[model samples]
Target: MKYFLYWGCSLEASGVNYLRSLKPVCEALGMEFEEIPDWNCCGASVSYAGANDLAIKVLNARNLALAEKKANYDIIAPCSSCYIQMIKVNHEIQENESLRERVNSILAEDGLAYNGSIRVRHIQDVLFNDIGTEQIKRHVTKPLNGLKVAGYVGCQSVRPYGEYDSVHNPVVQDKLLEALDAKPVPFPKKIQCCGSGIFLPEMDLCLGLVRDILDDAVSHGAEIISTVCPMCAMNLEMYQDRINEKYGTDFDIPIVYLTQLMAVAFGMDLKRDAALHHNVIPPENILKAAIGN
Candidate 1:
């Protein structure tokens, strides 16, 4: 199988390590992973600002055009924001020809045109759909038995304007965990927003929202929180200290990327996989305990 690896600006900057790790893993699994040729920023964070929708659509259309030239394979985005923006805007452009023409006019500058020929998908979807749970299970060199994980499907990846998965309940992460031989703990705030894009103007509000979600996960006996979004991982992992101080509680749940956990389950070296870069509480200790390491 082949895929166009689309890394948007946010991921290209701070989350490059993840892309680096995933590429090798995919290659080892006998998948052809190619970076989109002449890719540019997906105009990150601008799509949600109501008036800038056309501009965002045009920007993503450029990237899609680039991918279309490469192959007919699905464009796989590791970042949730990129996935949401690309998928949602593609849907919009296909539904509105007038809007598509307007966006194509902007793309004409770069000699790019989008006909909505390709589909945008997250790495999670590709892993589950194309790779299959049985294939993922076969890669699990070390089973994470007894490890209780709370799957956090950040808003953009599963909800709001993009309805890629179930809005109220999503089990993609759960299925991935099961393939790793890990227990998926159900929590109330699994689909809740992690205050991703609103962190700047609403810092306190973002922290409060994250705190509530973390508390719910802890209450549900989740030792670690797994997520597909880098922004969600950053907020939940990096802001835990402040959240604890403000709420008079010590919630040190480890925030792990879904890929990171899968890498570990696949028996990839934790240090080389860049799992150590996470700001949240380290999950290695808990994971070791669960596997009797």
Candidate 2:
């Protein structure tokens, strides 16, 4: 139940609410997270597009080295982008001696070295595989009462590394919601790309992707969409108005983190534990469904 937490750039900035909601949810579940000291960005997919392999690997390797020095716990990143970046580096270093040597040599400047002993995992993977639904059910004080929800499992979480779940279609979030008495609606675009990495550069394309996901969720009778990644949540929730303006459609969908939904079911404080106030599209309906207030 313990892991080295890596709070990437988003969690500290635009994704702050995700980190806020995560704290109490993990606390309620008896999960302990020791943050890796002085951890840098995992050099997201966007970074990979611009930077060289060595630069990205070095960034993640420094984090792995810090975690190794701190303790023997596995590293966990709540952000899907961070999870993929770090895991890719961890996977690569473990298999390629040349890559490891190069990364370690760069780290040597900072008096750090990564032996690739730690495992990098997404928080969703840990919650679904390690924590289990039974344990989660036991913590649910306020069942969702069949609240229709779409489990948006964005692209980065499962793709290219389907260790615990399917790459194209993941059900961990849906299964977890079911345990909380929430009815998971059939969302075809659950694993759809939100175009997060290229959102700024390709605004139109990203909006189309976001609009499609939201459209699918709304069409399937989802009252709200639960997400695992902050980037996805932000893209979906924050851009609804823009999407409506651009597409000549009226769409107001509430986007929430899966952990936030868990917090609601656990009967935790909406503002404190769930950080519902932070959501762009206020999930007032979700609040009413879960707590009947």
Candidate 3:
């Protein structure tokens, strides 16, 4: 199936590895994706934090309008924050006539408006629901036979949106790994917040939260952790060193995008995908071992 792909800001820069992985995996699955042109930022938290509801809605509406203009009703967003924002604003504009009129008023100036006909889908939903485990397994050239991976769905993908999966118990990522013939190591902290901004103001709290999650994964015998959200991956990948140093643990766990492993499991062109370049906890050797490259 073809959909308008929205790359949000992070996926292009901070999470470029995710971009690298997703393209090849989607191609492998015969899924066609075309990026929405002139897509603007979703302003994940900044717009909402300052009570700029109108500004934020307008910003999100612009992207939706762009997709609608392109005649694509389904928008596939890989970033959890971007998916949540688009879905949230789309729902609000559809349900509230007042909000819709207000947003339209602002959008009228630019000759763009959101009609709420667009459906925003996370890639996780596309992989699990649309593609299905059986279909994905058909493409697995090398099964992750002995690999143990913990699934982390994190906060943004579930709560406040709950469009694709459950907030309380999400197993989409784990199932995707299973499709690759890998062992899905379950953990209690799978759906917990990865402490996105908590690390900056309260280092202790953030460190404790991250350390606990990693500890649980390791204790469960997880060699790597797979997450769909870039923020979740970032928090786990970026701050793992501090978590280890502060907690006196020797954890060197690799946190990778679900698509990265998918590319490997599907036996796509890993070298061209360049999936191993971004994350601090590199997945090159781990993935090579899985596919016996």
Best candidate, TM-score: 2
Best by lDDT: 2
Worst 10 residues of 3 by lDDT: 194-203
Candidate 1, residues 1-293, lDDT tens digits: the string is 88888877666555554665676567657779788897877766644566466667777888888888778888888888888778878888889899889888898897878887898888878888888889988888878985889988877787655344576778888988898888898887888887887775788889899998999999998988888777887788888889888989898888877777777777787778735454347787877676666
Q: lDDT tens string, model 2, 1-293?
A: 78888878998888888999888898778889898998888888888678887888888889999999889998889999999988888999999999889888889998999898999888888888888999999999988989999999988889888977899778888899998999999878898899977887899888999989999999999888999898898788888889999999899878888888888899988888888888888996666756677
User: By TM-score, how accurate is candidate 3?
Assistant: 0.95
- Say which prediction, candidate 1 or candidate 2, comes out ahead on lDDT: 2
TM-score, candidate 2, is 0.97
Model 1, position 101: C-alpha lDDT score: 90
The clash numbers for all candidates, in the given order, read: 0, 0, 0
Ten contiguous residues minimizing lDDT sum, candidate 2 = 284-293
RMSDs, each prediction?
Answer: 2.1, 1.1, 1.6
Model 1 scores a TM of 0.92
> Per-candidate TM vs. native?
0.92, 0.97, 0.95
Give a tens-digit lDDT track for model 3, residues 70-129.
885489889988988888899999999998888988899989887778888888888888
Model 2 C-alpha lDDT versus the unseen true structure: 0.87
